[model samples]
Target: MSETADTLFSHVKPEQTGYVSGGLRDFFLYRDLGVAAATQGKVIAHLVKANMAPEKGTGWHRHEAEFQIVIMLKGWARFMYDDQETLVEAGDCVHQRPGIKHFLFDYSPDMEYLEIVSPADFKTIDVEPVCPIPDPTPWN
Candidate 1:
């Protein structure tokens, strides 16, 4: 491994990981994967869960980062990438370029995903809603 890689090694056990409030949605839980400290704030990784009411989501916003990616691990979510509605399900991945306005309108209760972004601490700028989003399906 390269010197940088060797210095940034990390091994995280699931059971030992803890979830905290997310950046955009307080209802979602986020699990840090020790990437921030490892990368010296160059990047960060988080496992996120949609544990809130179906009606509640991140709304319209954009990240102030150079790179951002999300890989769905379970369930699914509905988002508006600019003006296009996109459904991201399990085994799916999305690359959200910097400053790409999007709205997370709804999601399954069991939704889970891994999100990696450049710059450990990125800015989330809320924008005016640009589309009429559908209501989230009610969950049991």
Candidate 2:
């Protein structure tokens, strides 16, 4: 965050936060943990949970940021980092190297994860697939 505001300590509680729509993915809900504001947009920390059954999933895309990571808190998710498929389960943490083309094609019903990315105002750009994307598992 080269051009960032002064950051302050933040203590956010569930009671003070609310999951809202209008995130990168419409299929998921995002709850800001107050980090972006506290950190003056240097970074953002939020909890994202499934809002609907997995269908198309997040298409192949990349973020224009210096750092990003996802920590699964419950359930599981199937992702393709380039040509390799990786299954992220509860307690798993994934560091998505900057500008890495990836796809989250499937996830459990109750899937929820904490995502932290540097520079709150990052950009998500759609990219051509690096490999064939797998169909999502049918929702029971």
Candidate number with greatest TM-score: 2
Q: Residue 108 CA error for candidate 2 (Å)?
A: 0.3
My TM-score estimates for the predictions, one after another, are 0.92, 0.95
Please provide, for model 1 over 1-140, each residue's C-alpha lDDT reduced to its tens digit, 9 standing for 90 to 100: 34755347778888877988845578789998988888889999999997677675677898899999999999999999999999999999999989999988888889999999998889999999888888888878
Instruction: Identify the leading candidate in terms of lDDT.
Output: 2
- What clash count does candidate 1 reach? 0
lDDT of 2 by residue, 30-127 (tens): 99999999988989999999999988889999999999999999999999999999999999999999999999999999999999999999999999
Range of the 10 consecutive residues with the lowest summed lDDT in candidate 1? 1-10
lDDT of 1 at 5: 51
